[model samples]
Target: MISHSSTAHPMPNSVVNLYVYDQSIAGVAKMPLDDFATAFGVPKESINLNSPELRRYFLNHIQIITEAKPWQTHIESVRVINSNDPIVREYQELLLNFICTPVKRTSTRDFTFKYDAIIHQVITHKIMVNVVQDWQGGILGSQVQVGEIALNIPKGQYFPLVVKLQNGSWWKGFGSMVSLGMYHIAEGADHLLFLLVLLLPCMLVPNGQNWGAFASASFGIKHMVKLVTAFTLGHSITLFVGAFQWIRLPQQWVEVWIALSIMISSIHAYRPLFAKKEGWIALGFGFVHGMAFASILMDIRLSAGALAWSILGFNLGIECMQILLLTVVLPLILWLSKRSEYILFRKVVSAISFLIACFWMLERIFFFKQL
Candidate 1:
């Protein structure tokens, strides 16, 4: 993952996610009592927009900012998110304990039920009126910058993204993440190298110590399809499940396995490792690669609907690129495999992959020390 902090140049990624859920009802977001003492009317002294107390009041008063669709329901159960990080776990625990329990407040109005939770309702998105500041520290656009974007993001943690959903669109957010997924997959040299090395031998068979004549076009196409299919199936399973938080695997372990898979597959090109069962190897190792793919999703927590869209968009982007690359490269490999010199070429390619994969494994081991 590229950290926004490590480089001097800022690579700003506007990614806002659903982490905290407000547990309340009636769609009436509470304002700080100090700002407006009356529920129905604004007070005289608190009428000043410059007042610090009124500022906090208005910040909470921005309601239903998200343009909600008619079909979308807000009936989700308000529960704490599960996390291994102590800060996040404790934050969830505290939020749940504070918000879930009912609170009965006596009201003069003919209201039957009291407010259970002080916080706002849990939903897909929150609306906020943008609060910008003036050059002289006066509020502009009635907005405030909530958090600082310090350059250094700690490893093994998500880089902090501070975005105000003042006027942001849903599809735009989805598109940004999809673009990110495409970029990551495109830059994965080890993964591409692994695929390349494994692909070369698919068109040839073993003749004594060297590769035999090229397989028929049908055989080669079928062979490549099988490997690709198995790989896709294996990775997609882990990618979807991991993204949805069904199972969690240590990233370091997954990267280690990915590098190992590449090296082993490279050797298999020289001399068969799994023979006709190479699909099984692809399937197994593809799980590791998929887990690596799932890492981006682990960082940003989105509402269920948004998350579904994200998964669909990102996978579409990844698979499309993968297919495009294969479409262009496979024919060239098929052409080369027809020549007598292809066996040596295959050997040379595999050798390069083997060395690169070894280096990747070492790099993965010392991950904490790297950018």
Candidate 2:
């Protein structure tokens, strides 16, 4: 007999790969074949040559594979299907049949035990919950969707279903907004640092009677508020526009300009660079910050109305956090100004800010590649 050894080898324990696509956008996930069959209510034997459902499944698989692996365009579909040999196919079929066989209704005790087991698997194991959270953030940017937006669900969707639950309310939405605000502040270290440096100068003025101190504090507060507000307004406008496909700004230029703006502000802290026209300077630089903020929204492709709400919520969150920081820091800053160490502290903080700014400027301008 002709040797078949050249064409076939002993199969591994499993052969199927299940790819889950993002409901909002067609992305792919590679999963076990047995799991895929259970998820779709398809039989492994039916996945062979003749079944229409099998053919449909194969087509979906091919579509995702084509999108993800563009270079593999020349690969034949029949060849791809047949690549899993007899032993592999048998193993996959066995696993799928075992998992998908429906159980008969049992006693309440059995049901409770099973329910507890499922909860343990879901909550303690946590793989399912984490995957779902990541998928939701990819779509919603942590916003809680309600009403008709929640009804348009797709098959194999991975987002948290809680947002659509009857118990889900505005409190959840507010909490989500708060979480996103803190996340943005933590993630945008450069922005936070620039704001801190801006506050450093105010720390040097005398607390009560010093007219220069009073003037500087008043100016700083007004300038910071105007700058932040302008940034919020600019970004909100662009975010909606970009998300809805109205306009597209060059992202690379946006990032570079954002870094440059921070650098410029840091330099200004060293000496009064925009002393008289601080508001104008803030407005000009705030435009760049707006672009930076817009970049985040563009990454989240939501429906037009959803995008608008997200932009509003995100900006409101940012403003609230900024206000909170000011409330806590302003009193301490006013008190510190009257101290003997105030001038030294300002110089040291300003020097550090200037150094960081120079580093960022060089990194952005020359494409330093490594920070």
Candidate 3:
């Protein structure tokens, strides 16, 4: 039976006593009480083995110590023999095993392997950490995480990564830009419809003497090129300024204005609203499109040079797609114009465009809550 030391003084607030037992050793080889006392620099009389408080403190603070020969099969169990509380025991377990472990050295020979390993680990850990945070309501609640993971990565590194992943080459950025331009044209139904409506009037003029067709088609292409160019320049300027200066506009207001611009453009198509100064209308409206484009660039958070490259890439893509569409649609427009049902088709297209624009305007302005 364990005997209590009556002469034991109360343990100091800053000091904690613990027992490290080597379980692998046979009988009598367990922690020698004299050595434990000597190692801890405490008097033999201070050890109250039977005292529950002292026993708990010891259990929570200390881990069982063991030794094994190199390459020998050994089972080493680390037991927190005493602690102030259960939390202390857990803290000791975590600190002793994980926190106190030495960091592995990175060798020059295995730099690439280690670098990839580290990257994989970081990405995996980030994903897992986010998942855990979400589970704990740390992510899904009021807090939002932001900022780049690699603050040290150079702008040069960033451009290469963007180009490598996107275009497969830095110089082939133009090809990527063209592809993006085509995608934007194909995806932008409203923009395409607006152009289509403008094409309608061109389809009505009689064959050979189709002055309206020739003029409108040529003017439409010129206007589109000018308008898109103005838009690209305007947005590129603003995108760089806004991104670097950290200028942000209310997203809702921006979206509302964009929808409004489209609605107005659609209305112009219904009648000769912008008639003689159609290019001016396109140019003016293109400014609004510029802001929309800037918002896209801003979302990307690219560096100034890369952002410039992206602007070129994106605009080129838009231009290439527009040109392709015009090429394909021009002959179709010419052929359709000669047909008896051309006017009917034109009116129908214009009406659908107008209705869609109106719907968008309403959705953007009033259905803000739904979005």
- If scored against the real structure, what TM-score would every candidate get? 0.58, 0.53, 0.47
Stretches of model 1 off by over 4 angstroms after superposition: 1-166, 207-210, 368-371
| All candidates in order of lDDT, best leading | 1, 2, 3
Per-residue CA lDDT of model 2 for 1-371, tens digit only, reads 11224434342222222111122212112223444454446654444434555445434332211212211111123211222444455333222100111122211111000101111112211111111122223323422222111112355222222212223233443445456655786688776776676565543323333213434556556655665566556555655566565676777666677667766766665556655455566566655666666666565444465456666666677777777777876777666666667666666777787777777767666783321
Q: How accurate locally, in lDDT, is each candidate?
A: 0.55, 0.45, 0.41
| Alpha-carbon runs more than 4 Å astray in model 2 | 1-23, 28-178, 202-231, 234-245, 362-371
TM-score, structure 2 vs. true: 0.53
Question: Looking at candidate 2, what is the lDDT of residue 44?
Answer: 47
Q: Best candidate per lDDT, number?
A: 1
- For residues 163-226, what per-residue lDDT tens digits would candidate 1 score against the true structure? 3423334566567556656776788876777778778799876666556788788899899989
lDDT (Cα, 0-100) at 249 in candidate 1: 87
Ranking by TM-score: 1, 2, 3
The number of the candidate with the highest TM-score is: 1
Task: Estimate the overall C-alpha local distance difference test score of candidate 1.
Answer: 0.55
